[model samples]
Target: MSRLTLAGMALLLPGLTLGGEWSGYVEGQIRAFTQEPQFDEQGDSTFSLAFEPEYYQSWDRNQQSLTFTPFLRLDSQDEARTHFDIRELLWIYAGDRWELHAGVGKVFWGVTEALHLVDIINQTDLVENPDGEKKLGQPMLKLSFEQDWGTLDLFALPGFRQRTFPGEDGRLRSQPWVDTDLTTYESDREEQHLDFAVRWSHSLGDWDIGLAHFRGTSRDPSFNPVVNRDGDLVLAPHYEIIQQTSLDLQATKGDWLWKLEAIHRGGLDDPFNAATGGFEYTFVGVAETDIDIGMLSEYIYDDRGDDAPVPFENDLFIGLRFTANDVQSSELLTGLIKDLDSDALMFNLETNRRIGSSWKGALQARFWIDVPREDPMHAFSSDDYIEISLARYF
Candidate 1:
């Protein structure tokens, strides 16, 4: 279709459509961030430009309905890296409330506050592409249902000769544990493994709840040299498993809103087998005394596992937020926080500003005191850092 036709469809169909609809958004941002490696560790910095532009068109000419969504992303400065790239292409066919989607894309399985138990259905945020962005996009086929009572999603990743089913010894293994360096395994062309996931969401009066499950092979093992300890070419097979469950509740009364989220992550492949798995729960309560001003507090609890790469095996934080206008068009947030296990304190600040019709800007900073002296798996965390970004929508 012509650009004008698509633009017209995007603008008019949301209100006029009867059967099929065409809609989507384009967003881009530029950001700068810095990190100070703790314990005399090597420090790194980054500046980035990112984009997420999508276009989706759906049509139901008769009993058959079709949906086509194409997405593109480009980011410079992912974590400690300098550049990143990925693509998303999905097509769905539907009849009534049931539909099927195929190809590569992104999926948010459930609502978990800690982001630890929340599984990003593609690549588990454990690693990133050369450009620094998490490889959260993957190839798969999905089935979904959206009804008045609830929503359900079931998907499977097939075709790839990947492996993530607990290995023969039942010990979760990764490339770093098997080999000293991971060079070839980090590329997209070499990825091999089948992944699957399912998610469900329902609503009860003032509360909404969701359940999610994911099973996939490990990305860290895909690039193993397939050699033996004696330097012989031994084809030893390895696999990993990640099982998760979560519960979330939210209610609004008068000027107060309360939210609670709990998650349990375990299975054969979690970082630590010393324990069944680990859990991180979060609680958030907020009250609005005026249209432009509000007060809020958050609590977080973390449990460490043997294989887990994080420090102290646990952490916590509490804070407050303020807005300058009734519309919340602009806002600022700050708080004094303590690290539950380490007994460290920090000052954190974050702000957001909206622009005319199509753009927004954000700034985030954290000041750490008595920072730790260790580096965790994947990338290193910072003792102090500032992140600023501006996003525009087309």
Candidate 2:
């Protein structure tokens, strides 16, 4: 075994010896593309396997705890995709109305389904997933306090992680692959710069609101196209300092959920405003059965218009979710995002169900429709694909 794997096992020894809680899953997935490979030597299909193991140890009558979660992935097509990550390795202390966390961890801070404009704590692991939901663990010191009016959270982040991208042999990337090794940072301190953020959240009656501010290097990076020695145009990631203010609100009434997220970012060429608002309505016990169905609609707007990096500017997203109240616990979610300015549309479907007590299966598919050359998604127009996975839990 590798030294890193041995070290991870050493970290888990305490929980195993002390009889603490342990859980995790092992999964294997296959992805099949509907179109021809975009680049030479790229396969139309790929396979990947991942294993995650978590251990938790508590002391002082559960007042203090330590959590260790290690993840590893192996890909059949790209050697760059074979990686290891410590998703969570933290020590947590909980007091009467306060909490302290130290170590590497993950924090999610957004409510929008289509895009997460405000969730910027950790660097994204883009090669792991296309939806930007997967994130690399961040090193930080966090403190939170609960008061009558609201809950306040303070974070001191110290480390920066570069985003991962597919290799030349990968089927999902553009013709010129991104070179993550040549990343550039505007700040002289580079990735070693210290970052901080604060958040305040409150719940009043049926409404839940959160306000946050971050001053540090932006998690999202801009690309600079440069010709390499091989005469190939490659994109290099560039990170810059940014100050962002974000607001997120949600209201729950009966079977309806209303959501809104807005953000204003400074330190760019021009400050911009972006927002998304949506609502979801659920029909419980559909047709007197044990199934529940939910309908979702959201509007996305960005002041940058055509200059925006994402195709979500002036877009509409509609989705449906189904849940089956059964022992197997089955769920399905499907959504579509349509651009109002151009003929760009993207559809996604995800479904998962339990095979037994310790096994589960999942299926996911994405379809691009009528993509226009002006749209940012045009590069991925031919990359529509389906993925299926089966996982075993321990």
Candidate 3:
């Protein structure tokens, strides 16, 4: 058993009280997808299942309180392949004005509606490898401050698992595994980093506004560029710094709600070329008509220059989000299509219901189709896929 699982069993061992609070949640999901099933220009289709369980323990009885977070996930498919992943395992410390937290956990960064511009916080958004193994986010160490108006955080880059993704030629790109791979210059390597951030929130009557910023260096080792677009040899560069900022505002007028957020990026030493990082923005508006039905719209824009570190270009998007109860029961059972974008159109249907007091279940299905664009050589431009998933949580 993993260390986190052992800790969780310790909590329920009949007569045990460590003066701490313990909680846990379990989630299992199955997904079926078809990528370019007909056209064949985008990718391939797939069907898979996922199971994840998370546990936490927070101890605050004495002057020193610590928290523990741990999780595990397993994935399987009909292709006779199975994958296992350990998501997060970490310890934390807390204080009054100054709190110290160090652990191996996922972070969520970004604040937008349609897409993530600068939300570099931390969260694993379902990463799947070529072999279909679900890869979780890296672990990290963090320190934060709590004030009357807001909070500030300073964190250390994670030193955990490494991942490989598909390259331009459909080949796997290898990255360094900090713990397993040690070379001749191992002693000279820097294993830690500094991640700085600040977040503030305030409310005026029925309006709320939030602001946050995060800046840090890359933790994972850079991979060597072996092949260029034309099959030529190239070299990959090192990272300097990554800085991002987010501003958000939300106001509720009667039953209507409006939200806006913008993100700005800076301090990049350019990976592909040598230009600085650019910026992205997003906004959302929604109205709740009933308990189960609501209306929503979102927009996103990217303004990063062509020569910047990452080659994401300026694109526009607008989409809607609807629940099953928004339409008739027949339509709800058949699912509803709720998205239209510059490069793609999406059809999605989802349902959620509670089980016992500690359990809940959800089902989701989504289909994406790429709308024809002017250019086919662009890296970020592309196409069609279908994803269906069922999840149970507690």
Candidate 4:
């Protein structure tokens, strides 16, 4: 075994000795492409396997606890995708109205389904997934307080994690490869730059609201195209310092959910504003069959318009979700995002169901239609694909 694997195993010994609860899963997945490979050297299909294990230890009558979760993935097509990560390694102390967390952890801070404009705590692990839902663990010290009016959260992030990219031989990448190793940072401390953030959240009746501010190195990187000494084009990742203010609001009434997220970011060439608003209405116990279906609509707007780095700058997203209140706990979600001014559309379908007691299965598919040349997602126009996975849990 590699030294890193040995070290991870050694860390688990403490939890085992302390009689902590242990749980995890092993999964294998297959991805099949509907179109030809974008690059001749890349394959049209790929396979991957993952093993995730978690351990939790509690002390002082559950007042204090430690959680450890390690993830390992092996990919058949790209060596870069075959990697190991510590998703969560944290110590927590819960008091009467306060909580403290310290270590590597993950924090999610958005309510929008189409895009997460306000969530910026952890770095994106882009190579692991195409949807950008997976994230690398962040080193942080967090403190939270619960009061009558609202809940306040304070975070001190001491280290930064770089975004991972696909390898040269990997599929779903741009023509010019992104050299992640040769990255540039605006801060002299680089990944060691200290970041800070504060968030306040409150729930009033049927309304939930959150306000947050972040000041530190930006998680999003800008790519600079350059020619190497060998006259080959290359893209280098660049990080810069930035400040952002965010707001998230949600209102729940009956079987309807209304959500909104807005952000104002500075420290770039020009300060810009972005927002996403959506609502979901559900029909419960449809035909008295215990099946619920929901319809969703969302609008995303950005001040940069076509100059925005992401494809969702001026778009509308429509989606549907189905829930089967059955023994197997089956669920399905499908969505589509269409550009307002161009012939660009992206569709996604995700479904999952439980099997027996310890097994589960999931399927997902993504399709792109008439992606415009100016859009950032044009590179993935030919990468429409389907993925299916089966997991065994212990």
lDDT of each structure?
A: 0.48, 0.87, 0.43, 0.89
Candidates 2 and 3 compared: the better one by TM-score is: 2
Model 1 scores a TM of 0.62
lDDT of 4 by residue, 87-133 (tens): 88887889999999877789999888988999999998988887899
Q: Give TM per candidate.
A: 0.62, 0.94, 0.60, 0.95
Model 3 CA deviation exceeding 4 Å by range: 1-29, 35-49, 62-69, 77-86, 107-111, 123-138, 158-193, 200-207, 218-240, 269-292, 305-350, 355-361, 371-394
lDDT score, residue 213, model 4? 97
| Per-residue alpha-carbon lDDT of candidate 1 for residues 136-227, written as tens digits (9 for 90 to 100) | 44666889899987989898875233322211111112222233222243225334545677778888786667777666654334234565
Listed per model in order, the count of residue pairs whose N, CA or C atoms clash below 3 Å is: 9, 0, 10, 0
Q: Model 1, stretches more than 4 Å misplaced?
A: 1-45, 61-84, 112-116, 124-135, 147-149, 158-190, 218-239, 252-256, 269-296, 305-307, 311-313, 324-328, 333-337, 345-348, 374-383
Off by over 4 Å in 2: 1-19, 229-231
Candidate 1 or 4, higher lDDT?
A: 4
* Per-residue lDDT over 17-94 for candidate 2, one digit per residue giving the tens place of the 0 to 100 score: 455789999999999999997677778888999999999888777877788898999999977678898888887889
Model 1 worst lDDT window (10 residues):
164-173
Task: Give the candidate number with the greatest lDDT.
Answer: 4
